[model samples]
Target chain A: MNRIRKNPIFIIVSFFLLINVFFIITAGDSFFQLDNYFYVLKQTAMIIIVASAARFL
Target chain B: MTGNYDLSTGSVVSFAGCVYALMIKSGMALLPAGIVAVVVGILIGVINGTMVAKFNFPPFIATLCMMYISRGVALILANGATIRDNMPPEIGNLASRDFLGLPIFVVFIIIALLIFVFIEKKTLLGKYALAIGGNKNAAFFSGINTAAIIFAIYVIIGGLAGFAGVMSASRLSAGDPRGMVGFEFDVILAIILGGTSLSGGKGSVIGTFFGALVVACLGNGLDMLNILTFWQSILKGIIFVLAIVLNEKVMKNISKKTVAAARA
Candidate 1:
């Protein structure tokens, strides 16, 4: 548990979950749709690819 | 890698996309047009690299100047208009086509992620980048050819930005000079959210992937919730600040723990 607490990935994952929960509460079932998830994936693909360039930087 | 920031990536994306669209509209073959567009991006990178690595200009100032110059040139080339007519049908297909039920761009993302992860984990160049970023003078004394490495990093990033521009054009089915305006902010935000130190020396490609997903999710969720653009921007700002604070605190704790472990 302490090891997980110290991990940066843990923080990020927790933050991600927090945001999802917030959206779920506010937007309800629409936020849980599989199609919306895919839509998010497709929309973010380019940003993910470009953000990878910063990894080199 | 030397804690250098490239502010011109957004402009480079815009410039390269416009060039590709114009070439395709002018009847150039897709492959050739794409190559030229990427080359244009590389050329801009070379200029930026020279300014920073050769002339010793501050990275922020040099790239910021290049940003304006590239955007101006793109606007000129595009005649201040989006180029949509006479584009080849294949351009649209690039964005729409899927393989094995996955979007084509997602495949590209996966390929890019794998290649970059390999480079970061297994290559001498990766070591050199971290070394240079951690301490330039020490790396130089150790015979790292810091300038050359820096140049190469910038050039490679430029090429990637150019390719991204091509993808952007394909998605939009036109090259708008104004496309991707302020996009560098999103890229930087994603990188920071991924926990890549702005001060350099450490980063993770996988982390950046998730960071981008978070940003994308925020945008999509907000839009679905019928949030106004202004409110969405405000929310994103808050999240960005929170991410930075969280990252800093986490890093400090990790460093302190490492120090304690070392002493023990």
Candidate 2:
């Protein structure tokens, strides 16, 4: 627990999961589908690529 | 690494996209037009680097001026309209084509991720960036050629933004100066969420990957729920603030632990 708390990646992953859970509860099982996951990944790929510039900053 | 901000990134994307589209519309081949667009972006980067590094202008002010200039030029190029007429079939191929059951852009994302991760973790340039960002004066005094490094970083960033612009135009099958408005904010948000300090020095490409994923998931979920665009914007703003607060707290905790360990 303390170890996990210290990891920034863990915190962000937990936050991601929390948001997923919220959507699952509100939108039902449809929110957990693989197709939706793929769509999201596709949409955000450009952002991840562009944000790579921050690696230097 | 110079701890300099490039506020012109979004505008550069627009400008590059417009340039590419205009070239294509004028019967230029795909590869040549793409090259020109990227070169144009690099030119802007050179100007910015010169201003910030050689002239010692504040990064914010210099980039802000470039932002306005680039966006104005983009608007003028497009004549305040999207350029979609007579686009070649190949323009759609970039966005539509898939490899190994993945979109080409997703493949691009993977390649970019690997390349940047390598640069950040395994290269001398990475070390120099960290050194400069962590302490510019110390880096300069250590004979690191700080100006050159800063200039290189800006140029590379410009190239990336230009590529992103071409990708955007390809995806839309048109170039619109008005497109991608405020995109730089999204890029910055992903970096911040990935735990990159705005003050520079510490960050990781892998973390940025997850950060981008988190943002994508949030936007997708919101759209799935049929939320209004205005509401989505509000939620994104709230999340941005929350992420900042959480990141700050986490950084403080880590620092405190490190201090205690050192004392012990």
Candidate 3:
């Protein structure tokens, strides 16, 4: 488990999973909708992609 | 990532929302809607990056100038109208249309994401951009043409802003001189929220993705909860501040941990 935690892939995945759990718990019922999931994914995708471009520096 | 959504959602919202609001006000068409939004976004990005990296102008000052420039241009085009009717039909379709069970804006966001990721991962330019951010002096010393990299960054930003502008025009179906007021505010907020330091260097595309998501969720939640407009603004402001602080702390911790591990 510690070895997996050391991997960037695992770290990133775990971070995202924890974030999802937070949303599920705090966003009430809105977090459960299919549309909401898609919306969040789209939003997440945009920031990561764009910010990554800047990150190349 | 719902509860702890990326702050970039703020930018996406402002970009899309401004267009939608303006389109409803004037009735712009669809193609123009997408085009304008993209153009405007790229333009601002370019101007901000260029002035700071090349002229040594501070990012805050450079962007502050652009904020006014964008708004001023919009106001000039609109002839002083804030809201009006007779927007183009092409832009109107943007608000009304969806593709494959999703909003058109959603698709645009996806395309924007993929293109940027490709730029970051698959190009020499990408490495240069990161190099500049990570250590400008070192990059210059190592034979990287710092000015060129900055120029390319600005050009990309300008093109994106121009595209955003077209979208804005279409979304409103009319071009108002006053369109996209305080848009840079949202973009900055989103970028900051995604862990992009204002001081330059040390930011993550992945973090930014979450940042934008967080902003969008906040707005969506507020609207759903029927929160007042004023309260919404206040809430967003608070979130932006908190996100910046938290991002910095998290980055610090990550670095500290990495160092400790290395020593051990």
Q: How far is candidate 2 from the true structure (C-alpha RMSD, Å)?
A: 1.8
Highest lDDT against the true fold, candidate: 1
DockQ of each: 0.67, 0.67, 0.26
Off by over 4 Å in 3: A1-31, A36-57, B1-50, B174-176, B260-264
For each model in turn, which proportion of the native inter-chain contacts is also found? Answer: 0.65, 0.65, 0.22
Candidate 1 residue pairs in clash (backbone atoms < 3 Å): none
Q: Chain A TM-score of each model, in the order shown? A: 0.83, 0.83, 0.63
Q: Rank the candidates by DockQ, best first.
A: 1, 2, 3
- Candidate 3 versus truth, CA RMSD in Å, comes to 5.9
TM-score of each: 0.94, 0.93, 0.72
Candidate 2 on B1-264: residue-level lDDT in tens?
Answer: 346778888899888988988888888888898898889888988898888878888988998999999999999998888988887767665678789997788788889998998998899888899888778889889989888888888888888788888888887888889887777778878877887766667677887888888888888888889998899889889988987887777767776887899999
What does the lDDT come to for candidate 3?
0.56
- Model 1 interface DockQ: 0.67
Give me the displacement of residue B78 in model 2, in angstroms: 0.7
- 2 against 3, candidate with superior DockQ: 2
Stretches off by above 4 angstroms in model 1 are none
Give the per-residue lDDT of model 1 (tens digit) for B1-264.
Answer: 357878998999999999989988888888898899899989999999999899999989999999999999999998999988777787766788889987888789889899888878899788888898778899999999888888888898888888888888888989989888767878878887887767777667887887888888889889989999899889888988987887777767776887899999
TM-score of chain B of each: 0.95, 0.94, 0.77
